[model samples]
Each structure stands twice: as C-alpha cells, then as structure tokens.
Target chain A: MATFDSENAAHLHRELHSHLPSDPALRVKTLESLAIERGLVAPQTVDAWVEAYSEHIGPKRGAQVVARAWLDADFHARLLEDAAEAIKDLGFQGSATGHLKAVANTDRQHNMVVCTLCSCYPFSILGMSPSWYKSAEYRARAVREPRQVLSEFGVALADDVAVRVWDSTAELRYLVVPQRPAGTQGWSEEALAAIVTRNSMIGTQRDLPLEAS
Target chain B: MDAIHDLGGMQGFGPIPIATGDKDFAALADWEKRMWGLARSGVAQGVTIDWFRHGLERMVPSDYLSFAYFNKWCANYLMLMLDHGSITLEDVKRGHLLAKEAEAAPKSIDDVLASNAQANISFEGACDTPPAFAAGDAVRTLRIPPPGAHTRLPRYARGVEGRILAHHGAHAVPERGAEGKKDYQALYTVAFSAADLWGPEADPRDDVTLDLWEAYLVPA
Candidate 1:
C-alpha cells in the first residue's frame, strides 16, 4: 500500500488552485468529508460498496464461469450461446454485462479484447479493469499491432495461429474463453478455477497449469 | 473529433505494461477509491454512465493522461455535478456546500449499487430506423469530423473499409445521447483486415473488429 505524497499534493494545489481553491485530490476529499458531515453520505456505506468490488467481486467470479464451462459441455454451450442468461444461471449479473459474447481461443485462432474508443469492459464479471487496459498505449497498439502488444505482455503466439482483436466500441462485452489446459480431464470445476486468472480471460496472459495454481 | 482519446492503430506509443497475478482494486490509491465511491453515487442521482463518460471524453487528452484513472473520474464527476447545478463553485471553493447549496445525494450503498448496476445494461431498445448494412456486407466508414463534441466514432476508424461481422441491433446513438437527444441507430460489428487498416506494418492475418453505428458507415 502506497501513501499519498505531499510534494505531489503541493504541485497539484499550485496548478489547479486557479480553477478551484483546493487541489483536485484534496477537493474530492473535502467533498467526501462534507458529505459525511451533512449526513448525505455514510462512510460505512461507501466502505461496503468498495469492499464488494475489491474483495468479493473479481476474476474469481469469471474464473468460476470458465471452470464450469470447462467441466460441463452444456454449460460451455450455454455460455457461448447466451452469456448473459448463462452467467445469470450461475447467479452472477450486474452492470456492463447485458450482452456478453464469449470467444474461445482455439488451436488455430486466438482472441483478444480491447476498447479502442474507451475502456468498455465486462466489469460485472471480471471486476474493475486493470490500469494498463485503460492506458493510451494499449488502446493505440492493440488494434494496430496486437502481435507486438501480446508479445510485450509475454504472450508469444506461433506465426501460424491467427490473432483476432475484438474492439469493444459498443456495449458488447467479450470474454476470451481461453483453451483449457491438457491433463485436467476429470478435474472438478472448483479445481479448474484455481488456475484461472483475470489476465488470462482478458487474453493478455494464459491460464496456469494445475501445478502452478 | 480528431481528439487524442480515439487511440487505435496510432504510432509513437510504447508497450503495454502487464501486472502480474490478479488483484481486484488493490492497486487503487485511497483518493481513487473515494472517487470511485463518489462516481458510483452519482449514478443514483440520475447521471447516466454515458453522461459521465462524455464528461471524461470532454477532457483534454494530455490532462486526461496526467491524472490517474479514478482521478479522471473524480474530475469529471465534479464537472458534471457543477454543470447540472447540483454543486456550485462556491461550494467547491469552500470545500463544503452551504446550508442550502447541497441537494439530493445517494444515502445508501444499495442506491449507488443499483444505479451502478444500470451501467452494465446495454443501450438497446425498439429502433424505428431500418439497418443500412448486414453481416458480410462490405462497407466504408464515413469521412466525417466529429461534431466537435462527444461521439463514439473513433478517428482511426474514419473512412476505413470493412465487412460487417454481425448486426448488434440498434442502439441509442451516443452522439445524440451525449447531447441529451434520444435518437437511435442501427449498429454492427465491422471487421477490418490488418493490411487494410494499418497497411504493411500490420500482420496480414490479423483482423480488428469494432462496433459502429450505421451513420458512421456507407456502402462500399
């Protein structure tokens, strides 16, 4: 956990005071304090909301979806056919998930998702987006040079395997159903989920083997 | 519309930095978390997610990058509140709203979460206009400047030729929605070949698929 630095705070105050009195960061803090003071906002309520996303709702939810898809053929078909309904079957539903299209990475073709306009993501399932996904560099290069971008993320695909980048410009959210690893045939859904990670589903990284998990 | 935010197939940007393992919201700074909470609360107060996004897009690209992710959200949240008259400059300057300056704000987590949950729902409904293109139809993006305001059309995709991959039905055109208009347009997933969009620098085997409104495309 990193602490806020006063040097940066001083710099911000100096730069933005002309537009507003306090530093932007301090201004937000002050606003929060005022809200609390006026009973307009409860700190506990905010903490609970923050905790729900930070602690409970995350890749593990998506991992469960992936693992269940791996273990049950019917579930896999359901997820690909209508992800929203199928995801709801598992009791997971929320924002930015109204329409989910699950693209599987096969032996010959790979899929990666990027929002070129803005960072539109499957937040309800995958949780909050990573900073790099929202970065200008990723938005620019992912469509222009996906092979290069994936390689930078350490995902070096063979030349023969074609790469398809899904730019989430509209509301459609994509989940890259990464190809399941071998030798996990008889593994339970819970066991398979242990190896699934957030980046793997984003197609920037691969799922670890059972041993790695 | 030739703003910095529409970054696709552009040059000069470096590599994407990868974070190891999966940690949800663990990397966010305290102020970022506060901004997230505040922005979530804004949804309950009638600010649409698209509206908040438009405010973010309104920012200068350089300044947008200067702030962290939630910092950008915080800045935009403040702007929207001011623009909507929910907060005044005096309130902001004083670091607290005066007795009568404060209006409606979300009081509970449920209100915020419920409104935040609405952000996930796609903007789809009955669209009266007929679709101009279908799957497998060749089309070219229109060479039009953004109305100098918020639009979903990225500059990089402008005037580029592609094939419609799928019909995503009709959506409330973001350009109109940003302007507080309720116009709708047919949308489709258009796929452009790498060579077609990026020329020789791109690998020939790759394809970039984007969801575009009908107004942004013309029959090829």
Candidate 2:
C-alpha cells in the first residue's frame, strides 16, 4: 500500500480533475447565486457578513480586552473569573464568545488554544482564525507536541514553565491573556493595545513588543 | 466518526507555514469572503453549527484532506442547502444560468446584520440536575464505540483518567444538537497531565484540557 501524504493531496486532486470546473471559486459563486435567486439568502447579507468580519471585527477587540485586563485590576480579576461576562464590561460579546474563558500567562505557566476537531475559534472576539491556526498541521500537533509547535512559531518557553494546551472540543472558546511586557508601565490603554499582537492572544507568540507602534 | 477531522495528537504533518508580517493577516479572497458570508447566512437560516460540522465530518476522507479550509466549507454549505431542499442538483450543475427570480422579500443589509449578530450559538442553559462531578474530582472518559456520530469526545482523550478543573454549567450537547435535538448537560473542563496522555516522551510539567459534557465521564 502506498503511504498517504496530505501535503501533496491538493496537487493530486487538481491532477485528477484537470478537465472539470474544479475551482472552489466557481462553486462558491454558484452557491451564492443560487442562494440569492432562491430567496434563501440576500446578496447584501453575504456582503454584510464579509464586511463585518474583515472591516469591523478582528483582533483589535481582543487586543483591547487584553490591554484593559493589564490596566484594570478589577477587570482583570473579572476576566479571569468569567471571561464571557467580563468582556461585556468592555462591550465585547458575540458568537463563539459566549462560553469564553481567559487564561492568563504567568511566570510559572503558559497557555495556548487549538480546536483539534475543526477550527473552533473565538471569532467574535479574536476575529477569523489565522490560516496557520486552521491548518491541518496545527490541529494535528498542537495537543501532543505543543512545545515543538510553539518553537516552530518562534515562541520558546522555559522548561520550567508549564504549557497548558486548551483543546476547544466543545462550545467554549479561550483567550490566552499573555503577560504584559516589561517597561510598558504607565502606558495608555490604546497604546498598550497597539503592542498586543493577534498571535500573542492565541499563545503562538509570547513577549509583546515593548515600544508601541 | 473517527474521521480525519479528529486530528489531535496525530503525527507526520510538516511544520506550520507561518507567514511573515501582515501577509498572514491579508484580507480574505473574494470567494473565501463569499463562502464565509454564505455560511453565516445559512446559520441564520437555522443550520446549527453542530449540524454544519457534522456535514463536514461526513465528507469523503480523501476530499476532506485535500480541500482548502474555505473549499471544504463551500462544499459543506452546498450539501447543507441541498439537504435543506433550498437548492437542486440541476441548479448547481448549470451555475448562474439556473438562478431564478426570488419570490420572497429581500432582507435589508441591516436585517442581515442584526439576524447574524443575534444568531449566537451559545448553548449555555439551565440544567435540571446538579453536576455529578465537581472541580478536583478524578474521572475517566467513556470509551465510546467506533463509528461514532458527531461526538465532541476526541479519540485521544477516551479511556483516560483526568481531574475536573472547572464546571462550566449546563450547555446544549453537540451530539444531540447535530440531530436537531436540544439537550443540556453539565460541562466541565477536564485536565490531563502530559505524562498520562503521551507517557515519558511528553513533558512532565505540561498538561492538556478539554471541555467535556458530564455524560462522557465517570468516577475514576
């Protein structure tokens, strides 16, 4: 039996379907057109959702939450206690965030989140999941070999710092509250948020940049 | 269903293609954006997330492995619309030429926005019974039979003992939700040490946590 190689599977699919309208773009167009024509969905509805995610919603919401958590001690405590409710304190709540949990990175421990079964991310807060996050390689390895995966993402952790990998198996989503960077004291909330990268909240990156961009 | 989608703890995949700078943050392609919008619209039209995931899980393993993320989503959306009797095979085959005049009133963009905004899939609800296990209770996951259908229990965690880290109140069960049934059960965050799951090869200091329903567990 020949060994299966997932990396080449896409190429193999294209080779097999060389003569067909094998493009996914065509399929999406057909589906959208049919859906709209059948009154199943509005064309503007499609565009609205696209605009909502791409333009309005993204990592900035999560960054604001992280920045607030760093500055407000009460909010930080509430965020750790109940992230879903705490986020609403800042008016950040939506789908995929109802059962949220905020796990903070500390001196002794680090946290990361992955959805091994499909890409279950906190899209309402963190926006659409990153391509690397949704990749098969991440879903396959993040749970068993998290240290190695983090290393691949350029996040090296001390051996003593325990890694807590959250596998989003159910409805609940996670937001990893990375530790505030050093020398970032007395910074404004907006200034603090500017330094918090999307990957940092996802736990693929640690050590936020000190200088606000 | 013991499908390729349950990729946790699997091996032999290459390094993650971590794109540099803002390239990883590039805007979605036009088709990808349309696919995502269509998915949200479907959800607003009553397709549960669990049902959508189940449909994806039912895809042929080879195709599931080969297709891109949005490509798989596009395929699943078509299957769902077909199953829902909203579209026909002939319509899909003929592409844009099959488009018919819509008979229903078109929803405004604001309506769409509001509908989607309120379409939160939070399963959190009150449970009739108290939670069987509390935080710090030792428990073992049930080893469900093969050919499982739309279960949140991953293969790697089955038959393994772990301690409950937190009880997350009652939430709608995905397994039942996939079947168009609404059932609530107490959910807990279960913590398993890396040493227990992967043996000596794993770092002793590390651990993994999974949100599991009460039914999947019993006293260890």
Candidate 3:
C-alpha cells in the first residue's frame, strides 16, 4: 500500500496548506476527536466503515460481475439489461450502485465512465475511485476528448471503433464490462476475475491480460 | 451554482495520472481514512448526500480547485457540522470538544452500520408520473441556469440536443434533494454525439451519455 503522495496530494501539501496555514491532517484528527467526544460516532464504527470499504467492498466485486457475465450469457444479458438488479444475484448491490448500469465493450464500440459534476462512481461495487478518476483533468477532458484521454490511458482504439463516454450526471452509476481476452477459453471465473484490473472495469484499460495477476 | 466543481468539457488542466490500477482504500493516510469514515458517518447521521455535495459545491472557487478531493470533503464535513450546530469554530480551533454537555449517546458499531445501510437503500423506485420522453425521442437539454445551487446538468451538456437512450425510473432529484426535499423525477440516459457537443472537429462516431433528470430536458 502506497501513501497519499499523488500529484494532487503533493500540490495540496505544498500550495494549499501554505496559504490556509492549517494542516488537513490535524484538522481531520480534530474532527474525529470531536465526533467521538460528542458521541456522534464511535472509533470502532469508524474503523469498521474503513474496513468494509477497504477489504470487503471493491473492484473485486465488479470483477466477479464481469467474469460471471463473460461465462454466463444469461447473466451477461441481465447485466446489460438491469445491472442494479442483476448484481443482487451475487449480493453486490449496495450504496453508490443502487441504480447501476453496465456497458459492455465490443469490437465496434468502447465504453468509459466519468463523473463531470463530482466524483460519482459505483463505489459499492468498484470500491473507492482511483485518484485520477476524481481529478479535474479527467472530468473535464473525458467528455470532450475521450479518444485522446483513452490514448493517454494506453487504450488506443481504432478510428472506427466508437467511444461512448458515460458521464454519471445522476444517481445512476456505470460499470464498463471490458471485452474478455481471447485464448482464455475454459478458464474458471476466479481465474478470469484475477486478471480483471480495476482500470479495465473503469474503461481506462480496454484489454485484460490473459493470465491472472 | 455553476462552479469549478462541474469540470466537463473545459480545458487547460493537464494529462490524467498514469493508470496504475485502483489504490487500496487502506493505503490512505490515517487522517484521510478518518475523513472518509467521518463523512460517511455524517451521512449516516442525517447529513444527506445531496447536502454534503451541495456544501462541496458551495466552497470558494479557489479552495474548490486547489484542495485535494478528501481535503474538500474535510472542509465540507466541518462546514456541515457547523451548520448542524454539532460543532463550533472555537472547538475546531481548540482541537477538542468544548461543549461536553451537548454530547449525545455514542453510537455502537452496529448502530452506525445499520444507519448507513438504512440511509443507502436503493434509490430506484416506481414513478407515479409517466416519462415524458421515450427511448428513441430526440430531446434538448435545458440551457437555462438551474433553479437551485445544486444540479446534475453539466455546462457542456446544457442546450445540446441528444437522443434518449433509456429511461431510468424515478430517482432523487438533486436540485430538490439538496434543499432537504425528498423529490423524485424520471431520469434518462441521453446520448449526445461528440459532433453535437464538441463541434465538427470532434470525431462524429463518438458520443457522451449522461443520466439526466427529466427536469433538465425538453422535447426537441
């Protein structure tokens, strides 16, 4: 696990904190202390919430959904038809995914998801959004120059393959079902899921590696 | 408020960070984790998600632009706590609880989980009113400024003509929900061609789809 040293975090540490003169780390401590002191929330509850998102809920859930869809035509159809309801079959439907929509990748069309208004994502299924997905650069350029953005993510789609960018402007969240990698026939769902990278499900990576990582 | 938070289609930021896969939630600094937990716990305690977002949107443009994502969240949490009279500025400055008598009974882990679960029930629901547009209908998003400070309509999508790809049954309308009203409206996935939104220079084959409330659209 890496520390919070992303460019945005570094920029905030250097620039914003200098001007504000109050450390966000200290402020968070104060807030947590206050919350605990006020009996509004317990320390165990906070730890539990963190554990649930960090360990229990994440892209692994989305990967299982994708892997299942790839193996089961009926589940795939249901996923594309009503993802919110379909995910319930695997007990993966919850917050941030109550109104889920699944967009599949094909030779003709590529799908990507972004939230221009804010960092809206299917957190319940895909876990916390990557730092880049929440960055201003992604949110702004994704809708206007998706091909360029996709290329930056190393996914260079051919000119004819249409790109569809889904801006989550409402409660409805999206899950991009990346095209299954070829030559992986007769693979177990677990094996397939192991190779389903989070970025692939987020539509940044178009192709999955053949072997589980 | 049309603010810096609505970042669709504007320019001059920079390239997105390289794809390194999703970061582990546990990788976050302890303070960041606490910030996340506090914000979610705050939502569990009745600070509606809409309200929390509205608070973030209300941030000063400079702060909204400069602060890290969780930093903005921390600021919003403090602002909401202040608004809810749960904390005082002095208490924040002092770094501890100043009003001990005001403390409510501490919530157990189970209580917090239950509350969060209750707060996060599926937003999908049956709509009493029928959808005004069908899947194949052509519609133009309303160009007018939103009636409230919070709206899901991005500046780029407004006034653009798009085809309804699908109708998502009624969901909480953010404009009304931001103000603490329980309002549901028909939402649709409207697909706008790149040529339509970004002009002819953009590839005609590509399109952007947005799940927009009916209130943000009109029949073309």
Candidate that scores best on lDDT: 2
User: What TM-score, over all chains together, does every model reach?
Assistant: 0.89, 0.91, 0.90
lDDT of 3 by residue, B77-189 (tens): 66666666676666766767755544444466566545544443666666689889999999999997568767888889889999999987888888776776677889899
Clashing pairs in 1: A95-B120, A96-B120
> Which parts of model 2 have CA positions greater than 4 angstroms off?
A1-20, B20-26, B43-45, B96-117, B145-148
Local accuracy of candidate 2 as per-residue lDDT tens digits, A12-75: 3333233225698887888788777877777777777787777666899999999999999999
Candidate 2's TM-score on the B chain: 0.88
> lDDT by residue for model 3 over A74-130, one digit each (tens)?
999999998988988887776777778899999999999999989988877888888
Candidate lDDT scores, in order, read 0.73, 0.80, 0.79
Return the candidate ranking by lDDT, descending: 2, 3, 1
- What would the per-residue lDDT of candidate 1 be over residues B134-219, giving only the tens digit for each residue? 89999999888445356777777778899999897888777766555666678898999988887787788889888888888889
Q: Give me the runs in candidate 1 sitting further than 4 Å from their true place.
A: A1-17, A20-24, A34-40, B19-23, B100-119, B145-148
- The CA lDDT at B61 in model 3 is 73
